[model samples]
Target: MTRGTVILKNGKVFIALGYSNSDSYPSGEIGQMLVKALSNSSDEETVQIIRELIGGLQKDEFSKDCMESLREIGEAFYNKKAATKVGLDDVYGYYYDYSYVYDIKTRKLQIFHFGQLEYSFKKEDFPFLRLVVENDELLYTLSYDTKNKCFKGIDAEVKKVKRMKKAGKSPQYILEIAKSLSERIHYVVDEVYSSDCWPNAVQKGVTFYPSRKRLKFIFKENYGKWNVYIQLPWVRQGLIHNCTSRKAAMNKLIAYLDGNWESFQSGMDLYELYEDCQQKLMNFYNACDQISITKDEFNESVGQIEKEFRGKLIPLEELDYSGWTKAFGPDRAKKEIANWIFMTHRHIFDCIQKA
Candidate 1:
């Protein structure tokens, strides 16, 4: 059978020359030409060539051996241009054994292997191909020797590729998980708030954040699990809760909202402390019957009652307590009642000031 010469320049098959049908491809002049063209071509031209070659491979115009040859040529071109080019090309093509597209604009690289896109990376953000292959114990290995024209370890690479093909592909469940989590978050937010609170008290869309403040409740995927974080204003490291599933994340979010709501109501009650104290004292006295009691018993009862007034003293701090002390002077029962109120109020006031 007659031999063929598929001359690849940069990453593309610049010319395919042959006299007749070929069983095997020639390498001498064709390889030299490819190396020379790759060396001389600009980064943009090389990227375009890679794109076209990938397109051709996807079309299945070449055999597996031919595709491997093309990939080696493409990698050589990449090695030569990688050092100098700040912006790389996103070369899209078919996956034979493995293929990669390095995007020029985004500086992102996507790797396809075993008929699926397996990995993605940012330029300079990851180790070199050979290092990655060795470190990660990848099935196929990359060659760093740019001078070697022929595809190295073709037999072994093909065997590995075949084995990998036999092994069933792993489904990407993270995407489905993300979608489910997003929908669940939207639904939960809508259910928690009334229509009047929408776009005011709570805002929901692609993400959920408090409209009044810079606080944000962010959900993101970490490793294989969903992570929930409450980002507060002026805080670099926000509160984080790592969850194994979407259900756990949603539950955590609901709990956070419930706790926050309760705290908010408690804060509002502080402003009405004076009226609340009066009402509580009136109710307590009305409930009490006119009966003789021991001094120790009355003191013990007052101590129990004082617990209710502990945190409600913010509104009573500025009020004059001297009037009550003077009015109840020399009367043991009245003084005991007045002293209980004074002590509870004073304790809470001291705690608030220290805080």
Candidate 2:
């Protein structure tokens, strides 16, 4: 059986124990067992119990065999440190090897699906979405709730997807699915975190929400300042690759957007912070040697200076979006206004140039 643990940068942990037909056991069974293990708060003891169960998995008992594998993975964790003996402060938490887990604390999504699973994410402040296509291919999207701690699933129609047939390749089709799912996940996270526009009536703080419609880039008037916003959705687990089975045109459109959406957002002034950094970028324009201060250099300098002053200069890492506030000062509320104007002007220029 394949057993693993996924620990997010945040403490949110996902422990997995399952068998794959291609590997140790049936994927479904392993998944079920892993779920069972997580449901138990006392994971340390459960590991030992599972190990004993696995040791007895002989004499043609399928249940015994499956139990044995689960126990083996569990014991692997239990033996590392005896749960009862270890004090709270000295105890290190975890069991088995979890391959993928989403950490809500860190705002990072991780997945370790045995080639069948894929994943993606979206930011609350951006107009476009980001898809995670590094290790696994995405076929469908998955979403989770931070407050209620639940998952939202999308049953996107995949059978009629034309992109797969048009491309005449399975791998490419899977990649398209991964990209689409990633976009969807971004939408979901935004919905949970950002809610309505910046001035959402119900929720006071920042809000994000998922929408089935193409992102209608628009400006919101709130607190005497204009804020820009977009909407998106989240991909559900196991269904990521199902995008290829969708209708052809939509699949192709999603694929195109997956690759080009970031550029589209950039045109909308979504990455204002990056642009500001670029504009404020220092350079030595000397008589002969012109050297550019790379972003890395700028970041290191900011970090060092912040440490010396006991005040952070870079605001991107702050939970309160302090950079915009500090940069705009008295006009903090209208911080996004400048970006909207710039994006709009650029669009007009592009249209005029085309004409």
Candidate 3:
């Protein structure tokens, strides 16, 4: 059997006794037991009963309605005790044991464990109290409201953590290869275009545009792998080849330059292609200045269109008609303008025929 108590404001005391397994004894038998226990019990025994009741309340071992009544009674007891300059040891037990203390001056409840002060809570700031057993030791956690000058039970706070991806170092072999390849490409480009100008040196590689060529050579590290490719004028796609070893890539580049160098001597210039695209786009935008769209809106639409084009190597003939219509609207002039902008800025890989 488990027993508890409720001391009301009117000085009426109620003893709550019950079976631990949710069973109930006959009311007559319970009444007799309570009567016998209190009939000639000592002051120490009565105080022990009250202490057990408060302990049960702290442990949340009662129903919601019963718990609420017990809390009120506890608050009354503590307030009265505090007013009379009586310490919690007189009512609950000795300070050497685990117990709660209410200071009259501070109106704060101090929780102690084996004479060690564990936690303290001001009367106004007291959250719902929860007693938890961790590492075979009893501890308190915060939860619901304490506006009624009593601790109620609720869930404790939960912490969330976000994990990040671990960083890794690049391979030493790959770094060495990239450095060697950059120096080799720079040497070749400088040798080839010595009379005209020097090759442009980028982070991982070099670029050289031979005089009057439709295409330019770009050797660089892309997405961690080395690539030596040919970029064509006014074309979204390029002739790209990936190489793992520096020697293989250099051999391929030299062979392509040897075979195509004569053809590149007389063809469309790279700068002319860029200037033409810029002029056409500007002219189209100028013609549509009366339209309601802002430059930012046009740029956003163009970016979305470019992304769709880059996602796949779709040819000009087999282009998705509905996609661009959604981006630039149903107006024919706007669609035409957006298409031109997309063609100039969109990226392509291995689509040599389209270029």
Q: Count the backbone clashes (under 3 Å) in each candidate.
A: 2, 53, 0
Which of candidates 1 and 3 reaches a greater TM-score? Answer: 3
Q: What lDDT, from 0 to 1, does candidate 1 have?
A: 0.37
Question: What overall lDDT goes with each candidate model?
Answer: 0.37, 0.32, 0.34
| Candidate 2 lDDT, 40-123, residue by residue in tens | 455354354344333333324543454454344432222233333434213434433323333334433333333222222212
Clashing pairs in 3: none
Once superposed on the true structure, which residue ranges of model 3 sit more than 4 Å away at CA?
1-188, 191-215, 222-225, 234-240, 269-277, 283-338, 341-355
Superposing every Cα of model 1 onto the true structure, what RMSD results?
A: 27.0
Which wins on lDDT, candidate 1 or candidate 3? 1
Residue 212 CA displacement from its true place in model 2, Å:
18
Relative to the true structure, candidate 3 reaches a TM of: 0.23
lDDT by residue for model 1 over 158-273, one digit each (tens)? 33332332323222232232233323221114222222221222222212221112123555556667655433211222233567874566566655554453232232233244
Better model by TM-score: candidate 1 vs candidate 2: 2
lDDT of 3 by residue, 1-355 (tens): 3232222121233333122222111122222232232332453453454345434442344544444643444432323333235455355332222334433344344444433444444433222111111111111112111211112111111000000001121223323332333222211232222121223212112223223123355555555555554433333222345776544555566565544443333222223433454565455455444556555666675565445533322232232233111222213323443566766433311131133
* TM-score of candidate 1 to 2 decimals: 0.18
- Lowest lDDT 10-mer window, candidate 3? 158-167
